[model samples]
Target chain A: MKTDPESHQRMTQRRQEGHVKKQAAATVEKGLLIVHTGNGKGKSTAAFGMAVRMLGHDQRIGVVQFIKGALHTSERDFLGSHAQCDFVTMGDGYTWNTQNREADIATARKGWDEARRMIESGEYRMVILDELNTVLKYEYLPLDEVLAVLQAREPMVHVVITGRHAPDALIDAADLVTEMRLVKHPYREQGVKAQRGVEF
Target chain B: MKTDPESHQRMTQRRQEGHVKKQAAATVEKGLLIVHTGNGKGKSTAAFGMAVRMLGHDQRIGVVQFIKGALHTSERDFLGSHAQCDFVTMGDGYTWNTQNREADIATARKGWDEARRMIESGEYRMVILDELNTVLKYEYLPLDEVLAVLQAREPMVHVVITGRHAPDALIDAADLVTEMRLVKHPYREQGVKAQRGVEF
Candidate 1:
């Protein structure tokens, strides 16, 4: 007995109709303020993944590192070398190691300055403010000033802010916010070290 | 009136000592069951990002996509072309589109066969089971069999599972679990569509 292939056509047609309706409902187009926060891993990693996606589209990107020191991360080395990416590593190290509030604040301000320039330059389609939430959480930079700068950026420039402990105000202002909740972490529980490439 | 640089040297020395102690404490080396779940985005994207990092380390990766259709995703096209990557797209489409429980179950079983092969082949250091949780959630495949396959894989192989509605048993067995909570989604709030390179 021969089976009819046309039986699947109706299913495909219904799916197409649903998809078209959904697509038509989505009409807004503009740059977005995206936030990745909470205590889980993959916040910065996901942001860098976004950078890769943008790079695939041949779009320019700018990165400003806040609290992560000058540790040689493979992502920075790889993505930085890309012609469309402008990478900046600004902080000396984590605040605990520095132990100087004034110095940490100074470093954060400098990084913010660079981020502000990138957001306003109209050169990059996406700008990543890596660990900016940590700085904001620590109050190194005034919350209102940071928010104002973020709000006033070019309408078509996508901004990604990543770190744990994102400020409530930032969450309120973001177009997209993902909280990477820590369901489990090996470093804390199993004492497994952060492996190269996997952690860096 | 020149300041002494010796003070900063002491700080660096202390930090180095602390880091050495922490690094020395972590000695376990084995395979890991990593899960990415919840409502927000970046679950599968983060897994692909892990693939990129593993590639940077000259590692081989095998991807088994269960629920994602043969939709020409940029990630599949780009990663599948890599010399060190093996990619497979086994599903026709999402279950809603297929609208046939028996057909979906057959497709899932076929995908699971491929996944079991990859896990047992010992050729891949990292294997990604994209959207497998959805299949398990729908009971298309027996959860016990899936868990057994995952548990019995090569000792050094890292398996990453991505999707929503992951079973509690899987979560309990996982070494690491990250739940991407939806603080806010633009598609729901602003009616912004998923753009190419960003969503796919």
Candidate 2:
């Protein structure tokens, strides 16, 4: 590709201006409450990716799984084994499989207890509440209690919540929220089975 | 969590029915054209997570980055070093920095050529076209030509395209499309600058 001298100079000037603005605008440093929710894939997967990123930075992480218990995921096998990772799976299974509402509520409460401990430990730089939104939506755990613990967490400890149908209260309190809108899903449309590596 | 015998039997029966339905419904197996777009974070991050998942399954992957050139990302540094990954960065920088439309187009074309080669090689199970949507949005590469090549690629070679402002044609062609809607962004709203491991 060839570049003209004038165009190169103009681009450089504009970029410099934008850089200055960005540098000035971005000045805060604190923990972030990130929420990922929608009717699409990659919600938990993205949160796992964040765990990997934090691991890359040599930061300690805690993972509390609320709703995936029937199968062993590759992420848990790989990332859970990492030295800086403290992994805990605390769910009977999906609500559909574990028909007993009382059992599901108990499991969710147990998971939330672990999550609270992780958030208060001050050892973990990041805590991933995988599928906690679903727990919240089902009223397995009270929203006010979750919000209270989150608000009182360490100043620099980031928390990531992932699942569908995040409550309005959680959304309002979160600093970063990404709704994974489903445009197309093969399993829903093409009768495609979830594979081991790709889906798990 | 405790479960009564009656509740357990009922749950097991219901789960058996659901399993039978899933097994019967899921029959197709083929490669997927996945697109992650919109004005939210984790599009590329989610794609990278997929790469990691594929890597765990011992599959080779090809990555062609189109526009992130100015800074070194930890993902590139880590994943590029893996034996199964072929990583290539083929852009000058963002369009705003490069200002020269001709140069940007040429760079994008070169990247597309590399992407096409990776898709046709038959060696990679997955190919990630990182930030290619931005390239397409700028009309740097002809849309029809890109789609044609994608459609013609090996049936089992999954392709992941990530960026914002995806065109309608691509969405229609994709098997799985996730629009990462931006509900909240720390950089834009909370004046939180991008950190090393988090953003990269």
Candidate 3:
């Protein structure tokens, strides 16, 4: 077979291009610290996605929902069954719903106790604090204490805290911070209520 | 507010209604298992959402992406910089991209080695293994080895594996499994390439 000079040059060029392309797809070290901020629905939804992601990958995940005492969430019903995942919720519901400082404090204490253990034990790959900003916003938990827990957490642990009104200290300490501004919400409309499978 | 006998009964009825509502809410637990699968896009995007959710609750996360060599994904870049999170990747592109069986095996070994440490150490609450199914599908790593690692991993770790062609063993072992079926994709019609930020 006679090879044309131009064709031969083109083939060599293509091979070199392939080599470069392979080199370009260099593997990356995958670690993540993500923040879900915004006055919008689905922050928890997004967080659950990560939990399931880790679980699918055979990673351990721990979850604690602060100021969420209702216990009537889809996450609890589903994720709790997984041996790899542990889900806990503060039993304070909401200030608007509870309307009691003592009760909220008790709930916070219960959750805090568990959260502190996981953070210190270095037993999980991911830990989630759903609606933690509410605890900070309400001052139910001391900022310094929370900061200590975060700073002293195991080196391999990835921590995430969510809620409206993210404190300056928490934001400052965060490696990645995102603000999820409420663009538009169905709640703004009159006679509309939080629907199941979407809100709760 | 003058009290009337008939009005009093109505008020009492409303209070009872509220109590019942609260009780019903308390009986439920929110939970989910999201699986990122498909030949198209955004499996990791969905998984990242879960990580953020756990993080918002102040959950610590450990992440590992198998068969991915580059340390430049947005999630890794942000998470690696964060002290609260632990991130690790294969640092060697996929076997197809590498085109060298030995190199691919070494890459698999490197990522899995780190993952085994985190899983066994019980250091993370959640771990994400991006494109792990592909590795298993390609047989770059042994099935028994991966299964053993998963079986022996921490009880509390929530592991997530993302990619095409999840194995039966993995599916059987998973507490919750979701198959991200591709109903339609943007790439087929337009021939649009996988772009960073969107696909990576």
Candidate 4:
């Protein structure tokens, strides 16, 4: 597998050339519909990280969390404190605790109302629908309705939706989709209690 | 496919019971060797997000970036400005930009030196080795050496290593590993230029 130095050099040059071409060819720019979903983790954390990047650029962002509202989390508190960020935690709590379809649907609708405003009003450069996919998976919000709203959002605003079991329609509609597949989760596999900073 | 509401309620309660049991069973606590790998976006972003989480808890963090020292990044600027964070940007630029093998190895070693200090010193609760897996993949630093250092690090200090093509040994050693699989990437498939706030 190890090529000679000259061959290695040629391969590197070719790779460099291809990279340059790809960079040059990528000229189109617009808003991105990004989805982060899978069984692993970092789905929402990555969105929060993107929100931080926007904040670093001094851009305003709106964050709406659909689930995990039952307990206090550091990310919610941290982002909310920033003047440029508007963070909202929705739902009665963990869906398991509620275990009521009507209540879950109601909470999802209320969260969607706030999310729809952020996506439609163009008030922020980036909007994060944290755990929206989980709601959609449970049919708390009609998938078609959510997709239609997302499809018609402002042209230059990026929206990141995160959670497990992202529907196929959303994946098809998304410009960027990353599935955070679990190789191994510390909490579930390693018997590690959800730590304050890591899990929350 | 849809069950009756009564059946659904029973299912929900059963799921809730399982959730509670899992939560209760997870009692072990220790520093984790977390790896973010695979060919996808958000590997480094997730690590940065974890740093933010630590910051939210008012905990100090050390971040050592391996390959992205090429351009000015908003995350670096933001974190560097924070009093509690020590951020170091390493290497000349991208791997393709600097295709010198010996030079690349030298740079990787230099960066690893700084990283070793943060990880071993235990001053910070979290240490982020951004793009370290890329260096490992290139064999710039012998995997065994890096693994040994990581294994001997302080018990309560967490280390997050990120990049694509994580070696099997690293995965085996990791306490948690989440592979950010590329379901779809806008920059490649959609011909979208890497956006400022999102890509960086």
Question: Best candidate per DockQ, number?
Answer: 4
Backbone clash total, candidate 2: 0
Candidate 3 lDDT by residue in tens digits, B1-200: 22444554466467667765655555332222223444433356545655554554556777787855422356666566566578777746544344455566678778788877877777776777778787777676787898898877765566777777777887766544544433233222333333333234
lDDT at residue A151 of model 2 (Cα atoms) = 98
Q: In angstroms, how far off is B41's CA in candidate 3?
A: 15
In candidate 3, position A175 carries an lDDT of 54
Candidate maximizing TM-score: 4
Model 2 residue A164 CA deviation in Å: 0.4
Over the stretch B24-113, how does candidate 4's per-residue lDDT look in tens digits? Answer: 989887888999998878888887788888888899899888987422388898788999999998877877677677777899999999
- Relative to the unseen true structure, what is the C-alpha lDDT of residue B197 in candidate 4, on a scale of 0 to 100? 68
As for lDDT, the candidate ahead, 1 or 3, is: 1
Candidate 4 CA-lDDT value: 0.84
The candidate with the higher DockQ, 3 or 4, is 4
Report the Cα interface RMSD of each model, rounded to 1 decimal: 6.9, 4.7, 15.8, 2.0
Residue A87 in model 3: shift from native, Å?
1.1
Clashing pairs in 4: none
Q: Candidate 4: misplaced stretches above 4 Å?
A: A1-5, A69-72, A186-190, B69-72, B186-189
Off by over 4 Å in 2: A1-16, A69-72, B1-20, B69-72
Candidate 3 stretches greater than 4 Å from native: A1-33, A69-72, A186-190, B1-200
